[model samples]
Target chain A: MSVDLDLIHRYRRSTLTRDELVKVELELQRSPAWRSALNDTVDAHRLGATWAAVEGSLDAPTPSRLERAATRLGAPQHLTRIMGATPNLRRAWMVSAVVLLLFGLAVSNGERETATIALFLSIAPLVPVFGVGLVYGPGADPAHEMATVTPMGGLRLVVLRTLMALLTSLVVVGIAAVLVEERSILIAAWLLPAVALSAATLAVSSFVPIRNAAAGVAAGWLTLVVIWARIADDGVAAFRLPGQLVAAVALAVSVAVIAARRDAFSRAVSTT
Target chain B: MRTEADDRALLARVSRGDRAAFDELYRAHAGWLTARLERRCGDPDLVDLAVQDTFVAVWKSAKKFRSQGDVGAWLWGIAIRRLIDQMRKRRPTPVEANVLFDQVASAEDELFVGGLHGELGESLRSLDPDLARVLVATAVDGLTTREAGQLLGIPQGTVKTRLLRARREARDELARLEGDSR
Candidate 1:
């Protein structure tokens, strides 16, 4: 099909009716030769061939977070440290919690053999959580390209990270159970707070911004658990109310951020 | 033929561990890739990272090309993919940090300025988010109208309407610029 370049030029120079604009746009859209030229440009770029050695290509404006991230002395290194330390720290926390639990259990049950067996059985699920979170942090969003052009990748990344973190928390709690073998009553002690914190941490990621949220949630949860551990008889029960509230908000925020920014997420994934 | 040629020509050279070829490939494609990615990212540094990453990926995976399709498309496919990954990894920063392309002294500077430009580029810059995207997908990036619709999560007709709007804007801008020059 012949493209009337003159008509296109005319259309540009004068006010065309909406229908006329549409027709010219359609013509531009249908111009195979034009497309072939674009394709050739894409091809030439791929081939490491150019019409000439072009200097600078500006493309887009720079975003600040990236600037901050790149300029930060130890961001990637810090992220790497988190990768290395998380599992180890989690393991340490699990071991310490378990030791505490077992010591309490022994004190309460007076070295009863059956208590040891019960304690071992209770804390088994905690191991996996320790491993998963260490391996994948709460913010570990992996790369996927084609799917990034859609919203699916963002949703998938967030959901996957959430699951990993939750699993990590649960695993840590199980190990805590083992440590508190004798004080199985303490397992009865702050089990609710532990569970609540895990969910709340995941939920908080949505509202407080990306990098800071997980640490904030974890810090806040630990502080609360400690405060409750010190102050009350039924700390587990006390946690249920606040935990549920945070969890509800967290879930809402996660959903809203994902929904409101679906396009943004898609754009992110596409442009990455 | 495209794939075979690509494999024998570019991929083979890259796979042979030629950094020069990779660099050459990067230089050839970086301008256009930067331009397209800038449209989506609205950030220059991120676009630079994306461009750098596309080359890194090409260095690592060029051997995988197998030369079955257009290498430009393949490279673009890589650049576009990497840009999206960067975007997903971060929150959408409001897109205002344009490169100082207006300060550019020559076409060489324009070529390197990256991101979109010209009448289509200006029109795209002026459009609302949805309308702007449809124009980029169809006119600049060369996606089909249906494909543009799918990418933007809009209906096909909406894509058409938006494209029309973008074109009209471009026409007016082009006329205004021309009149000013005269």
Candidate 2:
């Protein structure tokens, strides 16, 4: 079976119209052998063959696997576009509402123990802001149809959201810090770590699928807040960790997460 | 085996002994899978392995598929697990090599034998690392122009223009090398 290399090249160069592309694709697909060859090349690429290797391998290849694989890997989705566009606003809203409630409750209780309940309450606003960042974070899988063929760089989006989240968190945390006005090493330690954790959460969440990460993050944040609330009320400084341990983990994790963001974003863009 | 009740229906048949149905399901979803896996594993090879592993796992555990739920969602969950597993495996074992591989290789070695020596090597040596990177990503990596653009944060058209220029240069260089050899 012969493929029109000239046609393919022209199409790649954007000289072909949509109708012509469809026609070319149809023509190529019509020749079962050519279709099989194309499928094998794509498959080989998937299996870790660089194009040069695939080109080399094509000279003496078996044909059977390609036939079966081609049919197995070509079905198109109808709703992919629609689903990709609509953000999961409902989930975002739910998370925001819950966080706001937690923040309000912590502030209104007026309970002063050895651990400052109001102090912990001050950090609560960071939750929803961080949640937005996490959901739209460096590599988040927005549950929209635009997940497919998104022309924008995921890393660019991540950087934008991360800056927004950090800026928002810093401002709100600053307000909380001022309102309390009783600065201590303990509060300093808690605030910095918490802010960093918020960034870490965004990075980590991007490594997984979007909905799963969102649900997991929501649950995890709630649990942390509840635990903090309990500890704060009991006058226990449960937020504190050994300074060295915290520093080491933070440094190492920050590096790994930054590296993984590229990988995660690439994966999201490819599969979406 | 795949009598299109829904994607869910195809998945159910895949749970059965229906290879054809499974093939149908895979065909329907592989593009999306490729896109997602591409994000995690920048190397296309690793992406394919992760995807294949995902389908293989799905085939083995079809009985575990929950019929009342979203099939694509379940498959995607499995895909993420498979991808992470590959990542865990690919994580550098932290070898003690202070010098990278290229630094250790000698120019006189058989590795640079034949016409690949001299100008081709010199030309490559002369390229800026960023230009070399762009060239490798587009020419060698098989990423679409759009993907290459996104990765490099350039416009798709710019990626195309750059790639065309790179290819032309490579072609001219190769031709010159052959002419000189003759």
Candidate 3:
């Protein structure tokens, strides 16, 4: 149980043989008395400095469970980190999406009224459109300027964050569609316009702030729905074949614009 | 009594994301780990960051603790490597060891550098601090020569030459000390 002074000297001075070195290493781990003995030798100020360092770091928070799950499920660390940091993936965003879906379902309930159904479907697509817009715009990221200098900051960040928001919104919408039973068909009709508008929002974002682009796309979409209904005398007319074709065309054109101007995705339109 | 088995059990809980166990493990080793790291690094701020980095890595990958040995050794293994990484990042200008020692010398290192190791310590006390550091890392800490190079922020070849010179000089110093005693 007695401490070996010469052995400790040789160990610290690196004068010990390899076998002797390994023995002391094991001895330190296995022997509490040795550790205590070593501790006893350290002056209080030096040990206090060590304790201060440890205590300071104890407050650095661990990763959240969702982030750990993302890593466990095989998302690369960089992608998971980006997704976790994205402002649009906040719990508030998901809660708002859920609220929108619930409100949509409640308003159109049992009435099967064409006007109410059109209102619900039209608003459904805007949920993801708003989310995609928030992925990489000025005012969307507090670190937007700092982020631009990072390798992952611009278009790559936008695309990854957009997929996250869009998929989460789809899940919320999908759940609502199943709950409405017969109205599920009307809910399904929201798919084409949802993608088209989300794409159009990002495409337009290449030239303007995301907030301005999202606001314009949402306003334009609602105005188009009102005009089409007035001309056709039916609010539900936009979910018809010609309307779906328009959504399809919009999707195709927005994608082409996005590809051609992809560099614009990395910086805020105003800054760029 | 806290035994090796207790460390393993704590590590088992740590692997399952138990925060309490993690905190317990950190408390058990952080002081000692910090003390040891300070010997190799002159900057306390960098040492603090290295300690934090070590535990953070352990938090993420406690499940990878497959060695049947003491958790203490394993923790030191991770910590020393992390210290090297932190040092590389900051690359603080090297100050003379004696100056660093005088400025920050805690009572314990006073014991280590002057009082504790006796005559063998006297021999190494004469060796160049840089060469002495390579010996401590590779020999006492069980790091490979390449790892000692990384830990000391020197080229591997430099570490090799320094290590050889250190061992030869330490031997000569011991012989001189013995001759003086006679």
TM-scores of all predicted structures: 0.32, 0.31, 0.55
Query: A143-178 in candidate 2: lDDT tens per residue?
Result: 423433355446554444445445555555555545
Question: Which parts of model 2 are misplaced by more than 4 Å?
Answer: A1-102, A105-108, A118-130, A133-151, A181-183, A214-236, A241-248, A269-272, B1-182
- Candidate 1 per-residue lDDT over residues B1-182, each given as its tens digit: 12225334756787788766655555445655554454355566666677777776776677788555656667666776666567556635543322112122233322322233345645644455556556656664467787555444457898888778777877887899899999
Model 1, first chain, TM-score of: 0.37
| Candidate 1 residue spans exceeding 4 A from truth | A1-272, B1-9, B12-21, B31-50, B56-66, B80-157, B161-182
Q: Give the local distance difference test score of model 1.
A: 0.48
Which TM-score values does chain B get in all models? 0.52, 0.47, 0.73
Cα lDDT tens digits for candidate 1, A147-227: 344433454544554454555556555655555434445344344433434444434433444334445655555465446
Q: Which is superior by lDDT, 1 or 3?
A: 3
Error of 3 at A76 (Å): 2.2
Candidate 2 residue A14 C-alpha distance from true site, Å: 46
Candidate 3 per-residue lDDT, tens place, A1-272, comes to 56676656555444554334334444565575555444444455654565555556556545567768999999897788767775543566678888887887787777756756676778888888777765455666667777766888777777677777777778877787676646436668888988898889888888888778888999999998888989999886788889999999999999999899888876654373
Indicate the docking level reached by candidate 1: incorrect
Q: Which candidate tops lDDT?
A: 3
DockQ of 1: 0.03
